[model samples]
Target: MKTLSFDGQRPCILQTASSVGKKEGEGNLTPFYDNIFQDAYLGEKSWEKAESKLLKTNLKTLLEKANESPENIDIVFGGDLLNQCISSNYGLLDFHIPFLGLYGACSTFVEGMILAAMAVHGNYAQKAIALTSSHFCSSERQFRFPLEYGGQRTPTSQWTVTGSGAALIAKGGEIEITHATIGRIIDYGISDINNMGAAMAPAAIETIRRHFQDRNLPNDYFDLVVTGDLGSVGKQITQQQLKNYGLDLEDRYIDCGDKIFDKEKQDAHAGGSGCGCCASVFSGWLYYLLRTGKCRRILLTATGALMSPTSSFQGESIPGIAHCISIERKTDNQ
Candidate 1:
């Protein structure tokens, strides 16, 4: 899937438990992970119920801020943590737009957005919204033990947050795609779930180097070059590795995982995880930065950990890949 790359519409901001603040500030919140799934332990309640609440809250916030209605939306491409995308399915039951369900692990946000933009650009749809979310409790219950269960996080681990993020992508609007460079999926099959940071770094560095090389774009072309979420370790490896390719991101490159939180002592080893780690923070701070002329151009490179039960059983290295896209502000006169 591809599209004419463009700047985002007015962005949306919704939080679950991220401890955002100053650089010297505390960091992302980690309290929710501790006792989140205890409610499930007590009852047979469906996962969609509580999650729908978070999704709806964020959706409503985005819709109201964008002055949009469900009927005005051409389609909603979404995904989340649950069997058959339960959160996305139940979350959009009320929106009434045609839905395209997607999954890219933590990279779901870009996958959805890219498809949605292509649909509108190709005249397949007039307008579409791409959204993705991840709740720490829901993920841990299925993937690992609850945090209150007192599991130790190795330095490579990431704390998933409980948040839903929505973006209202519009077509024939003030903003439009200006340039787009698609990336090939590069998987080394180095699958290690526990040590995700190192597993994901190679794919990220590969995609970033290729994207810049393919588009003939330099690191200074954009105000920031952002990655989906590689936690602290992956980010370091990516930066160092990118430099080897003669691409120095300098301080201009940042990680959504690290940026989502403003604090440091929250015990979140590296940073946040899940789809929301990138979607929500991008919709919030990045959007704010672009719309206000603070950031004129942005390069968002979302990475994925393509792991499966079968793959894990096969003891395959965590298959890692990354996709890259470039977005910038729309000039009034240009």
Candidate 2:
């Protein structure tokens, strides 16, 4: 079975925190963000260092909100879009906590959460942190072009979000991590780097389908079924493909990419992308809704286009993966 149920003392999302750059701060969900920086460089010498600072700020906010010291957190799982995951490495070094870095592209946050929850559930750690970040300036230089080039973006292209989000998972809280489904890498021969939505939609569809089947749950089981960084194109493709499989998501379906920014106003061609797109949205707005009881159940499936600049340069098709986790408001009876 692809899905695993944490039947024993399900791990809880104790707290969440987020920090974003000016562009993301201008988005509709900015009100929920913990910190916002007007400067893209975040007072650092380079975009890379700024990204590292963004991640550090997010973790610091999370620790403060949870009122826990670094010693209280047994382990931390984090990653980013930067080469060698420098953002998470340098950002978290000050905390002096044990760290395990991951690389799942845009799906990194969900990947970290799954690992953290599993660690707590298995008694490996009493508290664990799942975090990720991305910076637009840094990502563009690495994956596309440098800031000086002023490259034009395609309509299908997405803007990488400059932000970070962190979540603390422990044994007790109002929101429980109930189940999770690991995704399989699906490549449909899509080589266009700009059209990530098309390349990743298949994997999102497959993971959602498998989760529903494995859990014997209906389409409407979750109050909301959200995908990470699919933007407009990928969201449309996922909805259409799932319908073909006889599953109707209806209005409960949403994508973090689409939710984070206003396409028309923000000039975000397709919408937001990158690790921070989903991470910030989930840790900020979505967490608020769950905490306030506006939402009872949520299925967060973060998708990633698993391709590097080298792979794309070599004309290799992009492979996509997604990981789904179920978060439910703990009922009084439960």
Candidate 3:
């Protein structure tokens, strides 16, 4: 079975923090974020350094909110969109905590959480932290073109979010990590670099279906089913495709990409993308809903397009992957 259930001493999210750049700060979820930087550079010399700073700021805020110091965290799982995962490496260097870096493209946030939860559940760590970040400037340059080029964007293109999110996990909390489903890579022969939503939708659907089947859950079991950075195009595709499998999401489904920005007002073409898109939204808005008991159960499936510039240039198709985790609000009966 691809899905694993945390039946004993379930890991829980004790606290969370989100920090975003200037453009993201102006979006619809402004009030939910912990910190909003007025400058994209964050007073740093380069965009990469700024992204590292953003991640560090979020981790600091998470620790402060949990009233725990760096020494209390047993391990940290983190990553970013940059090459070599430098954002997480440098950002967490000063904290002197044990770190394990990961790379799952836009799905890094949920990937980190799954590993962190597993660590705590297996008694490998008493306290673990999951962190991820991405910057529009940095990702744009690496994945597409440099910002100075002023390239024309297609309507299907998505704006990479500039933000970071961190969560502190412990043995007990208000929100429990109940189950997790790791996804498999799925490709539909999509090659357009700009249309990542189309490339990743199939993978999200596969993971969602497997999760429901493995757990013997009904289609409407979860209060909400959210995807990581599918943007508007992928969200639509997922909704349409899932119906063929006898699952109807209807209004109960939403995409983090869609929720991160105001589609009508914001200039974001299709919507938000990148690792931080879902990271910030989950840590900020979704966390608020779960913490406040507004949402009882949620299935968070983070999607990612596993393609590189070199691979794209070689005419290779983009393969997509998604990882799902089920979170539930603690109740008196349980």
Candidate 3, residue 191: how far the Cα is off, in Å? 0.8
State the lDDT of candidate 2 residue by residue for 69-149, as single tens digits. Answer: 998889999999999999999998899999999999999999999999999999999999999999999999999998889
Overlapping backbone residue pairs in candidate 2 total 0
Sort the candidates on TM-score, descending order.
2, 3, 1
Q: Each candidate: RMSD to true structure?
A: 5.2, 0.9, 1.0
Candidate 1 lDDT, 207-319, residue by residue in tens: 77776776677668878989988888889999999888889889999998876665344666777777777776676667667767788778787777777655777787786
Which parts of model 3 are misplaced by more than 4 Å? none
Candidate 2 — worst ten consecutive residues by lDDT sum? 325-334
As for candidate 2, its clashing pairs are none
- The C-alpha TM-scores of every prediction are 0.84, 0.99, 0.98
Query: Which ranges in model 2 have alpha carbons more than 4 Å from their true place?
Result: none
Model 1 worst lDDT run, 10 consecutive residues: 12-21
Candidate achieving the largest lDDT:
2
Model 3 gets an lDDT of: 0.92
**Model 3 misses residue 271 by how many Å?**
0.6
Where is model 1 more than 4 Å wrong at Cα?
Answer: 1-48, 172-175, 181-183
